[model samples]
Target: MAEHVTPPGIDIGTMHPARRYDYLLGGKDNFEADRASAETLLKFFPATRINALENRRFLRRAVTFLAREAGLRQFLDIGSGLPTAPNVHEVAQGIAPQSRVVYVDNDPIVLVHARALLTSTAEGATAYVDADLRDPARILTHPDLLGTLDLTRPVGLMLVAVMHFFPDALKPYEIVDRLVRAMPSGSYLAMSHGTFDYLTPAKRAELDALLARSGEPAAPRGRAEFARFLDGLELCEPGIVPVSEWRADDEPEPRPDPAEAAVYGAVARIP
Candidate 1:
C-alpha cells in the first residue's frame, strides 16, 4: 500500500523516493512528503546533496562526450530524474543543436516534470516516456522513442544513478543486456552506479535501515560486479573510476575513500 500526497505544483498521487531526491536537489516542485523524506536522507548522509550535484555534473560531461567527441546524435536517458539544468538533451543539443534525446522515467511526478522541462530546439526533438528500466521491451519499443530515434543508428544509452534500485531478483545485468542487444554497433553505454565499496559496517547498516524505512532498496555493487555490466563493450580510457575522478581535467580535492563515495562511472562502446 502506498500513501498519497498532492504536491503544490505537481499533482502526482504517490511520489517515489527518487522524486524526493529531486526536491532535495533544490527543485521547487516536490511535495511536503518528499521534502520530509529528503530531510531524513540528509540526516543519514549529510553529503548526499553534494553527491547528487556531482552525479549531475557527471551527466553533463558524459553527454558532452557523446555529442561532441563521439559524434552521436540520438540518446536514450533511462532513469533520468527531475529536469535539472543542463539535462542530457540540454548538454548534447547545446553541442550539436540537432541531437535527439528520449528521456525515460516511470514516476508520474517525473512524467509531469519532463513534460514541463524537456523542450527541444527547433532543429532537434525531445520526448519523454513513462517506462521503467525493468521493462526494457516497453521502453525500447515506446512509440515516442521509435519516432525520435533510429534504431539502426548509434545511440547513447544513459543509465545514470538509477540501477541501484534493482536487486539481484531483477537481474540488472540481464536488463542491461536486453537494452544493449537492441542497439546497433557503435552505440555507447554510459552509467553511474552506486556501490558499497567504501562504507563501514555501521554506516552500511545505517543506510540499509534508512532505505528500509523509506521503502527504497539499496543494492550497492563492488568494482568487479560493476565492471561485469560492461563485459563485452569496450571501455573508454581510464576505465571505471570514481564519479569525480573519471576524466577529471583538474586535480580533484581529496575526499573519503572510494568505498565511502561508493559510486562508479564509466562509458563503453558496443562492438
Candidate 2:
C-alpha cells in the first residue's frame, strides 16, 4: 500500500484509530504501528476490512437519508477521521447545496488536512473543529462550529465508526446524549458502533485480550449495550442492525453477513 509523509510532531510510534481506519480502507495515511495493530485485530476478526468498508458505506447512506429524507441542512460530525472521498459535506451538499457541516476530531493530522483541503460550495459552508469527542460541549460551542452551523436549528449529528474507541470508562452513552441534548427536537443522529454481538463468547474474550495486549482501544459492545446510545430517540426503520444490513438498498449486491461487519448502525431523530 502507498504511504504519506507523517506530519511533524505526531507520535509515529503509537497507533491512532483514524490512521488504523484509513489503513483498513486502503488509504495511504497510516504508520507501521497502525498497520500492525490492524493486522492484530484481523487475527480475532478476519473480516476487519469488510467491517470498516461496511461502516463507511453506512455513513454515506445515513448522510444521504438525512439530506434527502430528513430535510436536514446542518450537520455536526464528531470523531471525523482522515479526509476521505464523499465526506459528510460532500454527501450532504450533493443532496442539498445549502447544507452546512462541522467536522470534529482530536487528531491533528485530520484537522490540518481537513482545514487545508476540504472545500465548500458557494451556497453551503464547511468548517473543522480541533476537539475531542469526549468533550462534547467544547465541540458544540467551538467558535468555528458556531460560526458555521446554527445549533438552534436542527442538525444531523454523525458519530460514525468512532465510538468504539470510548469504552465504558469513557461513558460513551453520556457523551452521545450530551451532544444530542445540544440539538433541537427535530435534529437527527446517525451512528455506527463496533459490536461483539455476532462473536462467540470465546471469540469475544480473545478479541478483548488482543486489543488489551496491542494497546488498541477498540471495545466492541453487544447489541443491548450499544442501543443505550440512542435511548429516548425515535429510531428510524430497521433499527440497530449490522451496518452492512442497515438500509442496504443502495449498497452493492450480495451484502456481507452481519457477523462479517460486526457493527451496529442506526439513524434516529430527537423527539
Instruction: For each candidate, give its TM-score against the true structure.
Output: 0.90, 0.96
Off by over 4 Å in 2: 1-5
Error of 1 at 114 (Å): 1.3
CA RMSD of each candidate after superposition: 3.6, 1.4
Measured on C-alpha atoms, candidate 2 has an lDDT of 0.89
Q: List the residue pairs that clash in candidate 1.
A: 197-259, 198-259, 198-260
lDDT against true structure, model 1: 0.83
Write model 2 residue lDDT over 66-156, tens digit each, in one string.
9999999999988889988879899999999999999999887787789887899899999999898888888878999999988789999
Largest lDDT belongs to which candidate?
2
For model 1, the superposed segments whose C-alpha errors exceed 4 Å read: 1-15, 250-260
For 1-271, candidate 1 gives per-residue lDDT tens digits of 1454543445454456567768767777666677777788679877677667667777888888889889999999999988889889889989988999999987777787789778999999999998888889999899999999999999999989988778888889999999999999999999988876677889888988888776766677888988988989999977899887676675366644465446899999998
Clashes of each: 3, 0
Model 1 weakest lDDT span, ten residues long? 1-10
What C-alpha lDDT do the candidate models reach, one value each?
A: 0.83, 0.89
